[model samples]
Target: MSLPFNNTCRFNSVFAGVLCTAALSIAPVAFADDGSEASRERALVIVTSDSLETQSMAMILSRAMQEQGSDLHLLLCDGAGDLAVEGYASERTVAPRDIKPEGLLATMMNDGAKVDVCAIYLPNSEYEQDDLREGVGVAMPGPMAEMMRDPKIPVYTF
Candidate 1:
């Protein structure tokens, strides 16, 4: 079963690519005109995993988009789902900077970003609703469906 290269890196890259492709495939079919009001306030939907680098990047990107006046919605799933658990983000993934993903998530929340943990998180993980940090909510299918159907919003995965 041994491979010539690092399997972890290979798996991660392939997984990331698949996720990105799925996200892109669900893109809204319509878009607001260039000068329209809707075009001015675009929304960003981020589906993130538990990878430290991915979480950090998603948070950083979310913060940047927020600064640009975009509404941010973050969906935490799989390993990334752990970030929603209170006091769980203890490891700092980014080196030299000492910034933790949880901290960035909190900043996004403070900036009015909507943070949601996947609906199946509790059933699939060892966490109860109370274990989730304050302000983190269980993602509902209805709203997510709407977001995916909205052409004005851009969906990204990390």
Candidate 2:
């Protein structure tokens, strides 16, 4: 005894199998999360700046990094600490071309980037805790150092 099917039914079954195989072959590539090239290109940026030009450049770089879906973390030290403090940045500087570091820090925070000021700098300087601008967090040297050590974390100092 033999099982038999019409030519039309045989064609339909073969076509259906081909469609199923094609769909399966294409589905994984479409939905797989194997850490593609785009994901591998993601990075962490650490900006340390005490100069007005450096601070301004850091802000621009942070904005561009965020636009490209990279992570940015800023550590303010030395005179850069002044950037994290309120009013000091604005009141102390009158350079005609100087970009207010405080404002740049604020914009960075608003963009979901993390801004950290050296804890040692906070108390030694005249800035009070409240004087530290909004969205600025305090970090000790150790963690900042560790972050800088990561090969994937690019450090820019100015």
Question: Could you say which candidate leads in lDDT?
Answer: 1
* Model 2 alpha-carbon drift over 4 Å, by segment: 1-49, 91-99
lDDT of candidate 2 over 1-158, digit per residue (tens): 23355777888999999999999999988977565543433344444556666667767676777677666677777777777776655544335656665666687678777888877777788777788777778887787778778787677665
Candidate 1 overall lDDT versus native: 0.80
lDDT of 1 by residue, 1-158 (tens): 56746797799999999999887776544442465445656665555566788788787887888788787888888888888889885565597677788888888898788888989888999999999989999988898879878877888788
Give the range where candidate 2 is weakest over 10 consecutive residues by summed lDDT. 38-47
TM-scores for all candidates: the values are: 0.70, 0.62
lDDT of each: 0.80, 0.70
RMSD of each: 16.8, 9.5
Candidate 2 Cα lDDT to native: 0.70
What's the C-alpha lDDT at position 125 in model 2? Answer: 85
In terms of TM-score, which candidate is strongest?
Answer: 1
lDDT of 2 at 110: 85
